[model samples]
Target: MPNEYPSLFSPAKIGNLTLPNTLAVAPMTRVTATQEGVPTETMRRYYERFSRGGFGLVITEGSFIDEKFSQTYAYQPGLANVEQATGWSPIVDAIHAYGARAVAQIQHAGALSQGNRYRDGTIAPSAVQPRGEQMNFYRGEGPYPTPRQMSDEEIIDVINSFGRAAALAIKNGGFDGVEIHGANGYLLDQFLTDYTNLRHDRWGGNVEGRLSVSVEVAKSVRCAVGEQTPVGIRISQGKVNDFMHRWSETEAGAELIFGTLAQAGVDYIHVTEFEAWKPAFGEEGHSLVSLARKYAPGVAIIANGNLHDPVRALEMLGDGADVIALGRGALSNPDWPHRVSGDMALSTFDRDLLAPIADIKAAEVV
Candidate 1:
């Protein structure tokens, strides 16, 4: 059969790496790693399934960058050391065997940390308490603890950790690219958020100040990986806790955020929203994906949200996105690309797949 969604299945590029298609599996937290942050055999199988299912690129779940405040959940994978990074080698080999490019999404959890084995407390740009309660699924209860404000020295160390982690990911984990987790209310987003970052120094106060950490992290990752490796950053307006957040500066903010990251030498920018097609600001404004394309013309744009529907996915490609990343859709239909191209019915996601704990189930491995 002729490919109905030509744009969605077309070949694409990010940096020097070429993808089989524009379909990518968005990074998702499964909490299936070992206690010491090492990637497990189960994780290898779980990620390999996506590649086998015809995904052009597979971005791993947010792996903690350092042993300090970067870890957010228990059993979350990390690239902090050689052991953890080396543990991912088999998984990278598996993905590559199936001809899918893999990217490691490195992150710092910062203040939203519900669990961190290495640290006694959390740290952030400021000491403000986050807006919402901890997620029950991630094994948390009650309001979040107010994080201690990070010192200047600590901030510099955190920046260095990102660079070191990126290097580790490529050197040991054998990843094709690195993605800085700057979205979803993580450490980078905490700095970007106005309420969370109230400092008057160079790292806070204004939008540029708030965005400084993310841009710096981008530069750090780019430097660590060099000019040839694909480096990207994920940007979003919503938080895992507070889902309704939006940029106050609107389009102007979008321009600054995307442009600065592109200027920092990132090869791509991944923009995600609750709904990728919806307007970013008011009822009729351009979507965040469109704004990203407008500002970062030279960089690849990956759009993620509730873009499970092929029509919506194709529409986004027309809007500005070079690739469509699916979370729930990919979870349900791992062979989404094959199903769409072959005109097969896609499966619906079952909530039981993530019930009780969001670990990778045995049934999902095959």
Candidate 2:
């Protein structure tokens, strides 16, 4: 079917990859992978359908970057080893064969992990306990125990891990690009949020100090992957601890974060929200997408939220979003890219088929 929204179908360049449209399947965890964190046949088939359906790009669910703070779920996929990368190669190859681009979301759990039992270490911006029930990711009872704060040397080590992970994803996994997990108060976002970070060192305190670590990590990863790979960063005002939480203290503060990222040589900036179209700041009348576009004028901006309709996604494109990334919309309808272009409503998410990937995402999360 011809697109009523031609702008969405118009080809756009995201770094070296030229995607077919603004529609993209956002990264989402699916337990379809093996318990050891390798891609399973189910994972391959699940992703293949998205590329088959019509998404210009498909970002695999968050894969752990390091063995220590990397994985938050027992069922989550990993990019740490060659075997896992080899397992994912076919998935990437399949996406390309079907005419879609593939990207990987690299992540570390930090303190949000509650139920995940790890064989090694964990770290956070501050050791302050997250406010919540002691879920399975971290193990134990009551709210999560306070995490151990990282030393200066430890922070650099993790940044190096991110760089190494990026290199591995490109060299072994065959990913066309990568997105750093900088949102939702994970390790990077945890540092950005003052409520979570109480450090007086160069890595914390004011916005610049707090944001320094993420910028350094971005620069290193960009260098690791070289200039051609599309390196994108995701930022959000909302988080697991408090959905209503804002990463920056104010709208202007949000601008500082976005603008800093823009100056750091990131190829793209992904702004996330619970609602895609709602004003990111009720007082400023700027949605996360708009604010991002405003600050990072030169970088390609992808907006993600509750965009369950193609028409709504098209509206976002018209309003300045370079791309529209579907979250649950993609999860429920593996064929979302195709169906949405034809003006189909989002598929109903299955409660039963969810335990595979959607379940236990982030260890303590849903």
Candidate 3:
């Protein structure tokens, strides 16, 4: 009765906001911003073209929340200052004009911040050195520096910074909402994982304790943004530096994490994996999206990772993903949604395309 990709074109709800379709441009780091962390024209055109090409929602690249400690790369944008928000305003307006909702992905880099210039030091839940060297693409070199453990006061400061950044993004930059970056082994993810979070304090010990920082930040951001705005968190079992990682605990560990966030009243949870449709763990048939649906039925589920194929994307949507996020898919074809809907030929994603930056620049959009 329905087209093969009907759900992909159908409207979906995240909190009180309704998107025209289930396709979203996943948050990616595009080092096109100014050194001072303001959005640039190149970045504007990059996102604008995606909206104009018919994507339903465009999530901006991760924007650091705290100037002092959250910055991760040179030219990475920030929402900590008014000028940064002002720079993002026109880009958000352009996306809205093209009928797509724009959501800012707020982040704190923690120990993975090799390009951070605000301070000479890095801080994490614990002083552990992360598993791998920084990606050279981000201008990072050599082994990662050992980070200082975050103090209780510093933790609170980071949480408040997320709240302030969310408020600034929506109230000042005109983003439709904010998505907290609790994924990709960033600051929030550092707190979520046991290997990185070796603290015995309230912040870490077990799964529940590891999840406390993210939960608190979500509550703070929600309170700052209010009930009308959609606030979600992006989470993953893996990190950029370590892709093969998984929860050391059982599946119940995931339930506890998702359950706790849903109870905190986050509008949605974005779950990412190397393959969106595959089972989350060894021999387990349930995918992360299904797991999220099971754990947090009341919350919207956004499934990301390797969803470049139209058939696979449709299958994932059918499998209970309220929204499908495209990373490299969108990277290659800015008109991915339109092309798939119309059965048009699509471009292939080249790893070389990610050479200097994450976002596709105007010159590279052939």
Candidate 4:
């Protein structure tokens, strides 16, 4: 018999926020935003579906914070202005009304800004071209346009932008919290992986050096959001540029990212994997979540990726993750949490059609 979750429905307090349960919605880019980069009705409805279905929390798709250079993809949402926030306020309010906490994930595309029409150039840790093909989101090329090497000033600017974004997310946009997009080989992960960050400055060299900017961003965001708002960072061993990419050769490398971010006052850590249950580091005696709990001590950890059923979700909680984020599972089965709690059989989701439904705007077209 599968291990039961006596505490699955139990409330978990994250930072100052008390969630209804241990389940959370991972922040995944929906790739659909209003023309001026605001939260559209489509997005609100998309998220509300999950919230109404009993998701404990819903982390919105990535919203670009720095418009000058960080607006990486076309149609990507932005938090650089008040107008966008005005559009976003309702979405957050809607999520809260349904009893689910709302969090906005702020991201900068760095070199992955394929259709990045916001500026003449983008920034990356180093100038080495990404090794993977660009997604169809950018209709123009392979890999992506090479990004400009960020100057010291530009680097500091990017870090501060994230802090400011967090402020707007809470005060102006009505978000309950914020998550730093540190994974999937984006801006923060670029600094973590050696294949991308080939710099000789304060932001590069060993694990400590590479982790500086990400940790600094967390520290800054904490200060900006104050001690009350929950803040989390997403990290993954894989990369958008290189799917098979592994940032650290050992668990020590993973520890550097996890421990340092936790020390910086991050309220939660979202660790992602192609499959959440796999061994994050072989030498580490446990899975990624186990290692996170071991090193961070008390920080809440959210694990995401391919969690297919209630049995798997229950297993993840048993594995040491404080919360489990479902992507495909939640999209197809909107009533997943309720169904699991009520003893209803889980729905069978068609993997091939999930992306469109995941991208579907339930309230508005375009």
Candidate 5:
């Protein structure tokens, strides 16, 4: 039989890097690293499984970018230092051995941090307390602490850290590309969110001002990785703490956000939503993936969120998504691409795979 999802198995390009297929593995936080932020052997096998299963691109979970004020959870892997970056070399090699490209998603926890080994407290755009309580899965209890506002010098440091980490991922870790974790209510997303960021300076206030840090980070990563390396930024309106949140500016907000990143020379924009096919703003609005394509026509778009279904996954291509990234779906069926293409039955995702703690389980490796 002809492939049911032809678009998903087609070749695609993100910057200079060419993927074997448009199917990608979405970044999912798996706090299974050593306490010192080194990637473990288990992590290597875990990532390699996806590539070995025929994924064209494998994006690792959000690795902490810096030693200070960046790590969000205990045992979370990092690209912050040489040792951590070096530790990832094997995993990258493993992915490459299976003909899949590896991309590191570097992030900063900011005010939403539940645990941090480098520092005692958290820092954010403003001194506001983040909404919602700590995630028990990541190992935290009670509500989130109010973070101190960062100074001008510190803001520059945060931007520089991203560049440094991207460089480490490329030079030390051998990653094909690096993704800036500006989404999911992290530090960059904190600045983008209005309530989370209440500053009058150039880093806050209006949409452009609020997104200034993201734009600069994208520029910094692009500069650090050079013109040839593929550099992308993940964008999402919702947060791990505030899932139902929406951009106040809606489509107009998307125009500025996506347009600015494209102008900053980002090769791709990864947009995620609870449901990939649903409208971004309201019943009549376009999906966030379509908006990203509309605003940043020059860059590739990776659409995440509930796109595991073959029908929905194929529909996303028409919606302007250059790639379909799977989270829970991949966890359930690492060989989803091969299965879909061969007309094989797909497996159902089990919450047990991530229950108790979100760490990588032994069963997942084999």
Candidate 6:
């Protein structure tokens, strides 16, 4: 049969790692891990099915980087400890058996953490109250708590944790690479966003100061993963906690941010928005992925958010995006790539199905 989406099925490379297709499963939170942040058989099977269904790359759900305060929810996986990294080996092996590359999304919760079990208080760039209430989807309730201001030393420690976690993920967990979670209003996002970061120190004064941590984290992770392994950084204007936020109001600002990451030596930049095709700033046609490519022509771009339709996905790829990452669309239809290729009907994703993530059976994956 003729392929419906040729761009999607075409091979794409991240550093030296070549993906079988441009379709990738975006990182999604499924709190089905062990209490100690270890990946379970269920988690392994969950990701394995995505690989079998034909995704070329499987970016695992955000795994907290450190035991100190990075954990955001109960049952969330971690890459900080040896045992936790070992837990991911079987899952990576399962994905690899189907010829898919697995990448760990390493993150820190910062102020949006509703389940920071390690430390009593949450940390942020500045002691500001987080936006929005805890999402009910992740067993979170009530208003977000105000975060504690991070000291310079603590900031350095967080940056180092990202490097250590990436090293552990590749060395012990068998992951192809690591994607630093610099988006979605997490610890890294907290620093990048102006409204949240009000500190006067080196880590929080201006745009460059705000972006310093994320760029440094990428550099550190790149060093940790070595030159062969791909190290990508995820960036977004809006965040999970603050959906209406925009990091840069202008295209020039966008260039500066993306250029910084490219200069930092990241193999790829994952640009995410509510809709990847929509214009990011001045007009309705210039999308975030377009701007990212304009700024970082040397880096691969993965476009995420509301790109479920084959035509739209194709358009993004036509616009210079190397990959299309599926989130909810991939969840409902694990065989999304297969369906798109064969031109089959796609199952509609229902948010209700994720209420109790553990109960998500394979039978429902179709």
lDDT of 6 by residue, 66-89 (tens): 989899998899998999999999
The models' CA-based lDDT, in order, is 0.93, 0.79, 0.90, 0.80, 0.94, 0.89
Task: For candidate 4, give the lDDT.
Answer: 0.80
CA lDDT, candidate 1, residue 243: 99
Which segments of model 3 are wrong by more than 4 Å? 1-3, 356-360
> How would you encode candidate 5's per-residue C-alpha lDDT over 212-233 as one tens digit per residue?
9999999989889899999999
Clashing pairs in 3: none
Worst 10 residues of 3 by lDDT: 357-366
Ordered from best to worst lDDT, the candidate numbers read 5, 1, 3, 6, 4, 2
Please report how far candidate 1 places residue 27 from its true position, in Å: 0.5
Candidate 2's residue-wise lDDT over 216-316, tens digit each? 98998999999999999988888866789865467788788889999999989888899878877765587888878888878999989988777788878
Per-residue lDDT over 160-233 for candidate 1, one digit per residue giving the tens place of the 0 to 100 score: 99999999999999999999999999999999998899999999988989999888888888889899999999
Clashing residue pairs for model 4: none
Q: Which candidate is the best by lDDT?
A: 5
Error of 4 at 54 (Å): 0.4
Between candidates 4 and 5, the TM-score winner: 5
Each candidate's number of clashing pairs is: 0, 13, 0, 0, 0, 0
Global fold similarity of model 5 (TM-score): 0.99
Question: After best superposition, candidate 3 residue 347: deviation in angstroms?
Answer: 1.0
Q: Could you tell me how far off, in angstroms, the CA of residue 300 lies in candidate 6 after the best superposition?
A: 0.4
Model 2, global lDDT: 0.79
RMSD of 2: 3.6
lDDT of 4 by residue, 243-306 (tens): 7776555788777778888898999999888878878766345777777877887799888878
